[model samples]
Target: MEFIIDTVNLEDIKEAVEYMPIVGVTSNPSIVKKTSPKDFFKHMKEVREIIGKERSLHIQVISKECDEIVKEAHRILEEIDDQVYIKVPVSYEGVKAIKKLKAEGVHVTATAVYDLMQAYMALAAGADYIAPYVNRIGNLGNDPMELINELSNRIVQDGYDCKILAASFKGVQQVRDAFNYGSQAITAPVEVLKQIFANPSIEKAVNDFNSDWYDVYGEGKGICDL
Candidate 1:
């Protein structure tokens, strides 16, 4: 499974990429507004430099209309690099925009997907990745894992090239469920992902091993000293 960070914070991106196995970075208008960089393009360029060209960068488009969305996507590609995946909400216009962008061989990620139908529409429209709102879906009294499982089965059964890039996670368990249910990728906040190592038992195990080693080798001694 591919892990992607869902914040535009440069420091978070740098740290996560350096320590964790992050495959990409994703940002929405709200996320960008958190930092509110004066020069948006320049800020994104800095992000690109930090992650490098190997990791995917997903940038959401602000337009809600079909024509404007298409135009905005082109602008994002021009401002960023061509490899950047334009994040378009899976609305009526967004599906249209996805198709138009795909026709021209542009990388697109259909975001804000809450329903199976919306995801199917984006898949048919040729989105490279379709993002489902996990927490949002659960808040509505629906099961998000069920959606991921069914969608994953359909993708294989029908042979669609698209992938499930699940998003909107509130905790680490939700992320694990996404992958366990067949999501090919998930984008979550750095804090949430960092919790994977927050279990006290994990740290205790390491401490125990170190104590045993120190008892035999003496304090501050190493294998090189031996």
Candidate 2:
């Protein structure tokens, strides 16, 4: 599975890129709200530069009408590279806009999905990606993993090219679960990525190896061997 840095912090994104092997960056209204930058587009441009043109930059549109969504999508398209995937909600109007944009060859990501049916609908509407809020589903007393698995099976059965992007990850377990269910990608926060390296056994293993190596040779001698 692929990981995406779901944040607006440039420093965290850079660190994540260096260590996590992320495929993209995902941003939404809440993420932007936290940053509260004066120029959202300018920040997006900086993010694009950091991630580079080869990686996907998933961005959301704040429009309700298909025309407005299209307009926003075009604006973002011009501002960023071709890897920009414009995200829209899973509402009635959003579905319409997704269809129109998809027909026009614009890459569209249908976000805010919570159920198997919504995932199916997004694929049928020609969305390039479907973002299901897995944690949100669990909060609402549903099993997000089962929903993701069902959608994965459906996508396989229909031979659709759409990939499941598991969003709204609450912790590392949700990320693991999403991947275990065959999600192509996951959007998680920086803290969660850091937690990937926080296992006690991993820490102990690294420490023990370093101690043995230090006992064998001094720091200078180890450096010389390298």
* Most TM-score-accurate candidate: 1
* Residue 70 lDDT, candidate 1, scale 0-100: 88
Kindly report which residue stretches of model 1 are placed more than 4 angstroms away from their true locations once superposed: none
Model 1 lDDT tens row, 29-64: 999998899999999999999999999999999989
Candidate achieving the largest lDDT: 1
What TM-score quantifies how close candidate 1 is to the native fold? 0.98
Q: Estimate each model's TM-score.
A: 0.98, 0.95
Considering summed lDDT, which 10 consecutive residues are worst modelled in model 2?
A: 217-226
Going through the candidates in the order shown, the clash numbers are 0, 0
lDDT of each: 0.94, 0.88
Question: lDDT tens digits, residues 1-226, model 2?
Answer: 7788889888988888988789899999999898887998899899888888878899999989988998999999987766689999988899999999899898888999987887788899999989999989999999999988999898899999988999997688889989999799889898987888888999899878888888878643566686
Q: Give candidate 2 misplaced runs (Cα > 4 Å).
A: 218-220, 223-226
